[model samples]
Target: MTNLALLGARLLIGALLIGGAVQKALSPGDAGGMLVGLGLPFALVWPALIYDALAGLALWLGVAVRPVALSAAAYCALTSFFHLNVFQATGDAWQMTIFVKNWAIAGGCLALMVAGSGAWALRADRP
Candidate 1:
C-alpha cells in the first residue's frame, strides 16, 4: 500500500512535467512569449523543457529520485516566483491558478525528495 502510494505520487509528478514539456515543444512561440513576458530570457524554453522532461523521467523511472526531486522543487519555486505577474494581470485568474499549482507541485517535489524511492524503482537509493 505504501509503495503503491509512492509510485502513484511519482507518476503524477512525472506526468505533469512530461506533459508540460510536450506542450511547450508543441508551442514554442507561446512558451517563448511567456518567458519573455516574465522578464526571463526566451531562450530558456529549451532548458526548461529539457530539465523538466529529464527530472520527470527520473520520477517515473525511480532513478536518483532525491536529487531529481530537489532540482524539480527548485525549478517549480523559481518559476512560481517569476510568474507573480500573473496575479497582477487584469481579468486573468488562470495565471494565478498556474502559480498556485507551481507551489503545490514544488511542495510535492520536496516531499518526494524526503521520501526517497519506495519500491519498483530503478535506483531506489544512492550507491
Candidate 2:
C-alpha cells in the first residue's frame, strides 16, 4: 500500500511537471514575458523551459532521480525566492501564496529524493 501510494504520488508529480513544462515550452514568449515581469532575465525563460522539460522527463522515467530532484529543488527554491521576496515586495498577496505553494511542492520533491522512486520505477533495476 505504501509503495502504491508512493508510485501514485510520483505519477501525479511527474504529470504536473511534464504538463507545466509543455505549456511553458509551447509558449515561451508568454512565459518569457511573465518571467520579465518577475524580474528575471528574459533569456532565462528558454533555459527554464528546457530545464523543466528535461526534469519532468527524468522524474517521469525515474532515471537520475537524485540529480533531477536536486535540480528541481533548486529551481523551486529560486522561483520561491523571486516570487516570495521580490514579487511580494510589490504587495501581491496572491503571488506570495503561489510562492508558498511552490515551496510546499519543493518539500514533496525533497521527500521523494530521500525516499527514492520506490519499486514501481522504470529505473528500479538500478542501485
Q: Report every candidate's CA lDDT.
A: 0.85, 0.74
Candidate 1 lDDT by residue in tens digits, 1-127: 8788888989999999999899889997777887787778899999989987898899999999999999999999888855567567544777788889999999999998888879769987542
Report backbone clashes per prediction: 0, 0
Report the backbone clash tally of model 2.
0
**Predicted structure 1: clash tally:** 0
Alpha-carbon deviation at 112 in model 1, angstroms: 0.9
Give the poorly placed runs of model 2, Cα more than 4 Å off: 125-127
Lowest summed lDDT over 10 consecutive residues: which window, candidate 1?
82-91
